[model samples]
Target: MENQSKKVTLFTPVKLGKFELAHRIVLPPLTRMRTVNGFIPNDWMVEYYSQRATKGGFLVTEGTVINETGHGYYGAPGIYTDEQVAGWKKVTAAVHEKGGIIFNQLFHVGRQSHRSLQPNGAEPIGASAIPHEDLVFTQQGWVPAEPNRALETAEVKALVKDYHQAALRAMEAGFDGVELHGANGYLIDQFLQDGTNHRTDAYGGSMENRVRLMIEVLEAMVDVWGSDAVGIRLGPSGTFNSMSDSDPIALFGYAAERLNELDLAYLHLIEPRINGNIEIADGLEPVASMHLRGIFKNKMIAAGGFDQAKAEDILEKGYADMVAFGRHFIANPDLVFRFKNGIPLASYDRETFYGGNEKGYTDYAFYEAYADA
Candidate 1:
């Protein structure tokens, strides 16, 4: 027992803020479009989250928009409305019933949104008037992204309030914590990267100016949930959504230093190889976590294309405190049990991943039934 105590495995317990996590396998936010009216969590979502929840395990909901203007894709969940908060209560209750800790990921997908998805059919807002370089999924099907207008100086400040309000709503809905969706090419990332942010205002220019919006937004949420219950995700090396920076190491390193001030619950970093859901060239060694780990003092989570061996390796080396599995969790409801018992994960069907029913959402059986079959 003394020899085993020295080893840090996926099942090892760790304290994240005030909660004692039973295991280090975290369920990061995934954009599964299974919500109902007004992008509200439905009964299916309750079942979906409950299936994945285990006693003392951690789970984060899909990227849930904070307000009406935050929508980007069709059917993504939101928490800005009274009805939406009530809907989310069912989801949080389900996870808690299984003794799992769940956090809601507050999101706003900037230029990645379309005019049709925007409130009053207005142009989506971003750091600048930069048009998205790729297609965005909308109710009209996959269509070329419409150009976004630069957010007015006043509007940018108002967004910090939006994040705070959303954090409050998350608390009301019975969530243990909330994570800001600052990663990928969302509203926060648009301001953080120099390539997209060409503004001369206080919100843009140098690295300090570019990172202001993210910092303000984090502070706003921290005010509502406190730093201990709030976390942030950052994809410093992610180029998805046409995101680019002159120098990622310096940019993210500086951001990490700033994040230390908040003393956030954890800083989730995506691997350089992960471009959203797909994996790109992985010839490079683990860079983002390796560097940011030295800067960010709190627990760190490293995600993207990680298997059992790779996940364990980083944990053992003290590079990351946890590993988030997306595709595997989508296929294996009892992922913790499977990993503990050496059960092979079931293959996931990509076709049914988005905008789907029970086929890929909650029908993935538990390992006990799976083995019996």
Candidate 2:
């Protein structure tokens, strides 16, 4: 047992913001569409999280829409309504019961959303009127992304207010902290990327103007949660939802420097490899994480198709303070233990990953249980 424990570097404890994690293995935000109608977290969702909340480990909830208009995918949870906040309380209580730390990932789909999911069938909004040619999964099945209208300068303040109010609700829901979904070509990413944001306003054009909205939202969230209790996720080179920056090195390097000024809890960076897995763009260099590693003067998290060896290497080299696991955690509720003991992970069925009941969600057997059987 001692030998097993000593072999894994991921078992080491670290402090993230106000919470101290027992280990570096994090359950990153995954969009599992299993919430009840009206977008409330249900008992099933509570069980799902409780089963995976390793003692002293960190877990971030699925990408939860911040408001009604932020809804895009079916079954994703929301943090806007009183009922939704109350529903999430159960989830937070369960995780806390297991001595686990959880964060709510506040999300806004922006131009990536379909009109049917928008407020009163209204057109989706973005930094500009640019329409994403990609398709988004909705209740009616996959459909073409609706052309989005540019947010009026006045409306931008309201959008920031939405993020602020959502963070407040997250606190009421008992989350340890909140992570702004500034990655994955969502609303925040739309504003951050030049291809998606082409307006000649205060929010677009130069790299400084492009990063303004994200910084404003981060500042607003900081007002509610304090700098230590807030975190931001950035995909400096991610191409998901067809996102790309003209010069990721300059844009994200600046963003990291700016975010450092806020003293954020951590900067969760999606490695270029993970973003490339979704869409491999030629000449796309994976240097943002490495470059920002030197710039961001805070805890850094590196996530993307990482295995045990790679995670250990990154941590040992000080590339990241923590390593977040997605697919590995999905199929192994006792993932931390498995990694510590060198147990093989059960393969997950991709078909049942989203919009499903408990079959593929909580039914994955634990290491002990599977071995005993």
Candidate 3:
């Protein structure tokens, strides 16, 4: 029992870009489809995030699409609309009021969308027209996603501009910073993965060429928010959205080494699993995210399947600077307090994880407050 209690040596301050984090705990981006139609933030979102503003590191909002054409799933937040920006401002304001730092994750789903979510029924856009066999959640139901029309060489430049504009809107909306949503087989990740990006252009083929779009998006965002206020998320081995790559080490290793030069705020990497299922891999192959720790010189945060003991060991071994947990924070809004006091976490109900009223969203009780009530 004594050894178990002393196993975790987790409580330590860390510097995340310009902000000094009080703890090495983070709230990774967890997409909860609770926004209004047209993807605007709402008062419920403000309260939802404010409730999770405990003493852990920082909280990143779920992926908020950059433009209307970038929209892929229904009820996700957006940064392209003035109304959406104003709505997010309320959320950011609430987080700040609670003495917590928050960042808006700018995203675009690309080929992972339906025609109904696009502009004038336009097909989703990707680096290539290769159709993926994944389903997109829509108002009707989960349906096979449409193949995206490949972006013309010139049109790709316009999409980068959308990321830049979204960065500007994030600042105007009172966010501490903007994190580029480059992970989870989204548009940016699609461009980075060789399996999906089979174009014979400057933005494909070789590793440098394949990473051009992501680098360009980073450059564009830096122009608006500066490097200090920007970060990126990468899921090199994530199989979510039916994603696969022949060689993720070659693909992501080259990317991590190259991105070290940017010196962005923090590089968030998702720990890989077999087909999005978090089971121990049978083989001892070096994990995609573990390799990134040495390659990326900036602050690094690791997410997926992180518990207190594991996070403490990883931190002690210098494998990661911070640890992010999504579902844990969802069930225990006062996660930091619970960890400090060694209180049990509230069990999360899977039934209300997605779209719903306040039952599972804002009604989760805090340890101290809920016990008192």
TM-score, every prediction: 0.96, 0.94, 0.93
Which prediction has the highest TM-score against the true structure? 1
Per-residue CA lDDT of model 1 for 294-330, tens digit only, reads: 8999988888888888898888888888899998999
Write one digit per residue (lDDT tens) for candidate 2, span 24-96.
9999998888985889999989999998897899999999999888877878999999999999999999999
The better candidate by TM-score, 1 or 3, is 1
Query: lDDT scores for all predictions?
Result: 0.88, 0.86, 0.80
Top candidate on lDDT is 1
lDDT of 3 by residue, 173-201 (tens): 99988898888788998889877888898
**In candidate 2, how many Å is residue 150 off?**
0.8
The per-residue C-alpha lDDT of model 1 at residue 272 equals 81
Model 1 TM-score, all chains together: 0.96
Would you list the rank order by TM-score, best first? 1, 2, 3
Give the C-alpha miss distance for residue 87 in model 2, angstroms: 0.9
